[model samples]
Target: MTDATLDRIAGALAGMVLGDALGVPGELWPREKVRSRFGRIEEFLDGPADNIVACYFKAGHYTDDSAQAFVVLEALLKAGTVPPAKTLADDLLEWVRSMNGFEINLLGPSSKASLLAWSKGEDAEAVTKLSLTNGAAMRIAPVGCLVEANEHEKLAETVARVSRVTHSTDVAISGAAMVAQAVASAVAGRSWDEIRTDIAAIHPIALVKGEPTWAASVLARLEAFEAMVEKLGDAPSEEDVSLLIYRAIGTGTMTSESVAAALAVALWCRDPWLAAVMCANMGGDTDTMGAMACAICGAKCGISGMDESVVKYLETTNGIDFRALAKRILEARANFTIGD
Candidate 1:
């Protein structure tokens, strides 16, 4: 692997963990409530008691978004490419059990249902998947890392195959596909100006690989993001910019909304730390958006864009060695080809 890619991969992992931990304190908060409570979350804070989801964890701890992303990364390292659906499912089930996800209610609606069905002996492909959540997109950055963006067919196939265990709907797959492509493109040193167009084009291409659905399209949401960015003009206040994305593109857990919001944040606020704080305060699905957005930002700029103290704390808290993980991923990726 190239030295530059190795650095970006480390940054992507750190950025992902950092964003997740930062957002945990106010997951699902209203923008106003977030502003009223914390002003601007420059550092990690414990989840407020009233936040049912965030309340389960303490300061600087990544939530299920990054956890599941690690699951996918582990699978990729083991498989040296795309693992089978059952392999990924089995690993995810282990994560749910080991993390006490059921008792803690850490699983998303789609993932929980699919995991429960799979645990109950339902075939992976047979699990009912009507929900169109960002569960897949949240954990899909590893696919981006392992597969280059030029191989969109392979990328789409791997994304669909792995995501089948949880979210297999068209909308869900479309969102996941775009994120994976974006991260891959960013890691490859492509500018967001170009990656934005790549992801928008990738939406329809990957959409066809999953079960047809009537949900809001990720493409439409991304298109909406363009107008929101344009309206921000040369210099909008942070409050105004945050509200624009919250109100226009949204920041919810839906595959369409959060996925697009993450892309917008990655484009609008290219700094990894800034993106994390912005997502944390933006409300809705803060952690997932932070994870996604920061993954892209970190991929583009590497760990150089992150605060050294924050990255160090994230590594120690999570027992994560981003450099080591990047090396392992590079080794695994070396074994993969678009044909595989």
Candidate 2:
């Protein structure tokens, strides 16, 4: 891979970690409470009395979003390609069972369900089919980056395989596939809109209205973001800016809404640090949204594009080494080519 490509990958990875960390502080707050307490949501608020943020602050780590994403990254780093369904399933089960130290910081419902099924002696594949949650989509960004675009079938199959190990609903699989395809398309220099459209075409049954319903919602919020950026300029108070964007875009159950909110922050904030901060402050499902935003913005800006503070936090706190991971992913991709 070229230095430029490697740099972009590093940026994306860093962005993901930054988003995860920033969002950890505000995982599940009601929209009104988030707005009232934080008064504009910037730079990880304290908590919503009792929410994921409080747990995260006490533990100093994230939930299943970051853990599972790391697992996906580790799997690719070890195998140099997407592992088979059984392999992925086994690893997931093992990870859940043997989780120790800081690893137990985050455990989502879908993962919990899978672990329960495994403990009960159900086949991993069968257990996964029973899930309809967003677990699969939450950790799929890495898959999109590793596979080649031409290998669409392989991509879909791999997504289905990995998702079925824990998430069985078609929505879960489709959401995961959408995220994977989005990351792949971004790495290949395609427009986000184009990528969304293509994924919709590929999985008409999985997506609502054959397009991500949230993209439009996100697009609508972009105008508001632009307005805020204009009014506040570069040094806008983080709290005020966060609330402005959050209220306009929303923080809710819809995956598109959450994803779009994060993307809007990235689009409005020229600085990667600001983008990550804004995303985390949005409160509801903050980590996932922040992670998604970071991935998209990181792809656009590169590692050099992020602020030193954001980079330092990710490196020291999260223990993420983007450059190394990027090299490993590239090498794995090359090996995949050779094997083919």
Which candidate ranks first by TM-score, i.e. highest? 1
Off by over 4 Å in 1: 124-128, 337-340
* Model 1 C-alpha lDDT per residue in residues 12-53, reported as the tens digit of each score: 888888888999987988888888999888889999988888
Q: Could you give candidate 2's per-residue lDDT for residues 55-159 as a string of tens digits?
A: 635222445576777787787678766676566666776666666422544466556767666656676555555555556766777776677654666676667
Off by over 4 Å in 2: 44-49, 52-54, 58-62, 97-105, 124-127, 191-275, 337-340
Question: Which window of ten consecutive residues has the lowest lDDT sum in model 2?
Answer: 208-217
Each candidate structure's TM-score, on Cα atoms with residue i matched to residue i, is 0.96, 0.75
- Give lDDT per model, in order: 0.85, 0.62
